[model samples]
Target chain A: MTSRKLGGHFLSVMTVVIAIVVFFPIFWMVLTSFKTEADAFIYPPLVVFQPTLENYNIALAQSGYFRQLVNTLAITGFSTAVALLLGVPAAYTLAFHPTKRSNFTLMWIMSTRMLPPVGVIVPLYIIFQNLDLFDTHFGMILLYTAMNLPLVIWMMHSFLSDIPYEILEASQIDGVTLIQEFRYIIVPLALPGLMATILLCFIFTWNEFFLAFNLTITKAAPLSVFIASFKTSEGLFWAKMSAAATITALPVVIAGWVSQNSLVRGLTAGAVK
Target chain B: MSTLQNSVPTTGTARPPDKSYLRQKLARPAIIYLIVLTQIPVVFTLIYSFSNWNLLRPDRTRFVAFQNFVDFFTNPDMPVIIRNTLVFSLSIVLFSLIFGMMLALLLNRQFRGRGLARTLLITPFLIMPTVSAVMWKNMLFNPAFGLISSFLVSIGGPRIDWINTYPMFSIVVIVTWEWTPFMMLILLAGLQSLSQEYIEAAQIDGAGPIEIFLYIIVPHLRRYIEIGVLLEVLFVLNIFGEIFVTTTGGPAIDTTTLTFDIYKEAFLRWNIGRSSAYGVFAVILANIVTIVFLRITRSGTQQNKEAA
Candidate 1:
């Protein structure tokens, strides 16, 4: 009994230590966000300092930073909505009325995800430029939609498939039209899954850096690109950069925290099953 | 009309009622959109890989056969970039898996503040990659004013320019910090899903904790572990933001992965053809890894089912 008590105490201490280590950097970043430029750069890293909203004020006041924030919100929101609009119907079809070719189509959709974004990015860059879509909100939205559609379809498909067939069969026998069945039965039943898919898609689009960095120059630059602009001028503005980063990361971080369980499901969908 | 009606009845007798029309109509938009989105760029990439198209020298654009491929293979930096990619990806994946599993195991047991602990532990994975990289680069690893440097200096040790002195290792550390949370969450899910009856049975059979972990827990978590590693590999192989932010794949290309290499070729040097070839190589490599991963997981599930 004594040994078990000792073991329990040991595990608790270990858990706390591990948690602190994982959370420290994020804590430090947020703390630095409120520090003045002088305090932020001070060696021996002040544990307690006068906190201020100066950094946030400056970051938010900057037209560039504010624009990127709006851009990120718009792009992530519109793209996720568009992805679901296209993906949900397709997933419903594949889940319920799977034909001989349905499995093949599903696999093909997934394989498209395996194509390195860098591989297709070159052509996309050229095409976007040629079509005068470069650095435009519409272009970013289109690309993000394409990037997320497969995952959305796959996740929604898994979720919709889990709905009991009996319920759907009953609806079918009641002389419900296909559109009505989808609208009334499928949509309501799959609401939780749809929410999960939306959250996952939003998080992904919000955090995406590669294509956003490559495809946009100024007009459509999202938070990722905004933060990246700090990279070149990092030495000069450590405090403000930290501030910018904290602000840039806040939305997705909150989204991630709120929907972590659904995140795991979305991430490990096909792989787990 | 009579012949068609007869055929419909015969077909209904031969097979299940066909839902082709509805299914096709429903699936068509997504399928067509995805094909246009994915196929066009892939086809363009394929075609461009064979041409001599430098954005700088547009007049020199011509069909170059396998010249770009040959050049990319023979480049002096090719081997170094490949090695960096392997070491960077493998180190991150292996360490994250180990740390993740350990954390999952620790969190799995009943402990005080378990929910808060789990939330705190997952914070890093939630941060944007670029933001995470910046925080690490500026706040923690900055040689002069960063936390680590401050600690080192206070201990009377020399300051270390993390990115300049150890570029690849710095990248690996930053990436591992970001990704470990993801692995832990997935493994934690797997761990929680395990039946407690088996562990209780093992304990009653006088099996030690070590024995139970090795024999029972490891086998049960194998699928989750594989999933985590494969997914990590898929993402890690394509990591660009961290490297780009910290070292810019520099100090003489010490941290350049294949993705960064392609970015450099296309954007910096404007070597469109060579970049396309490199891109093709990356695609092939990624596909190979993905195919093997799928095969392993497929067979693993099949075996489990058969045993059941």
Candidate 2:
């Protein structure tokens, strides 16, 4: 019994140490974000330094940071909104109305996600250039909406399906319309799941890079692009890069933390539960 | 009210005619939207893959038939690119899974500040991939003044320039760091779902901790492990941002994956036909994985239904 107690204590301490080691880089980045330029790249990597917001100031001032921030916000917000707008209704239909094609439809929607963006990017780039959608908010939003729609549909479908069909049947009457059923009954029931879906969608779109980098240049480049610009800085701008990276990553990190519980459900498509 | 009377079901079935109509209406927009924005582009890609086209030499464009694909398969660098991609993705997935499971098991135990620990652990995954790459490259992996260098010197070790010396390994480390939390989260969910009675029963039957874990826990986590691995494969196979930001596909094509190869061929080389051919292969690989993933998930769900 005593040995078991000792073992448990040992494991707990080990857990704490490993967690710190794993989390150190992010902590160091946030820490470095506040350090002076010279102090940021010291030989011993200073843990104790005069914290300064100079890096943040420099980072924010350079590279159209404000524009990128706005673009990121706009793109993430609209794409997530549109995905939910389209996904929720479709998910509702699939969950409640079991038509012959419902299973096929769900699979087809998911298959769209599996169509790697790289496969279509070349053609899409050409099309975007020809159609004047290459570097616009509308273009990014359109792409992100498609990127997020399958996720939204799958998550919302699972969430909606979990709400017992008995409740809907219990509430239904002869003359009630489908919209009324959705507006009053399903909406209230699925609100929590909807929030999770929205948060996940927002996070994915906010942090997305591949398409964002390839598709947009200057006019609509989001924060991901902003962060990528510091890639080849060759360690000269460590502090500024940290500050810029911190700014770009913080919101999504917080959102992910907040929705961590539901995140598994969304990510696994409710497979685990 | 009178029109409602006509629409309302007065027969044996309680279902309304308009409800199914509305359901179909609800489903159409998303399907149509996806077809227009996502599927149409792929069709165009297929068409472009067969034609010889270069943005730089537009006048020279013509039907290339199988030439582009032939070039892709026979390219001298094809083997190296394929090897780099396999090594990069497999190492990240395998290492992250091992470490993630260990962390998950540890976190599953009762401990102080477990929530905080989990939160801190998961933060890496939430950071933008670009940010993660730059942070690793500039702050941690730098040979001169990096934390790793500082620590190595203090410990009487050689200071290693991680990115330049071991480009593929460095990328795998960064990506694995970002992905470990993902695996942990799913595995932890699986662990939490395990019934306490099963463990107690094993203990009562004289099973040691390792034996119990090996016998009981591994089997229980098989489905979760499968789901996690498949999902990781789906994402990690197309890893780009970290590679792009860190090595730009290498010091000299050392780190180029199929996705990056396509990107370079199309954008840098202006060889659209060749890139589109590469793109087609990427699509096929993704679809193959997706089909298997869908099968497993479907069967798993069926098992869940049976168990429930």
Position A211, candidate 2: lDDT? 91
Number of the predicted model whose DockQ against the real structure is largest: 2
Off by over 4 Å in 1: B1-20, B297-308
| Per-residue accuracy of model 2 over B1-308 as CA lDDT, tens digit each | 79766765444355656765776668789999999988899898889999889999999999989898899889999999999989888898899999999999999988888998899889999999999998998888988877888899899999899999999999999999999999999999999999989999999999999999999999999989998998898899888899999999988999999889999999999899989999999999998988888898899878878999
Model 2 ranges with Cα > 4 A deviation: A170-177, B1-19
TM-score of each: 0.94, 0.95
TM-score of chain A of each: 0.94, 0.95
On a 0 to 100 scale, what is the lDDT of residue A204 in model 1?
88
Candidate DockQ values, in order, are 0.46, 0.60
lDDT string for model 2 (A1-273, tens) is 999899999998888888899899999899989998888877666888889999888878875998999999999999999998898998987888768988888888888987888899998899999999999999999999998999999999999988998888776654456666776688889999999999999889999999988899989999998888888788897888888889999999999999999999988877765
TM-score result, candidate 2: 0.95
lDDT of 1 by residue, B143-255 (tens): 87778888998999999998888988999999999999889988998899899999999999999999998999999998888888987898898888999999999988888
Task: Estimate, for each residue in A196-222, the C-alpha lDDT of model 1 and write its tens digit.
Answer: 889889988999999999889989999
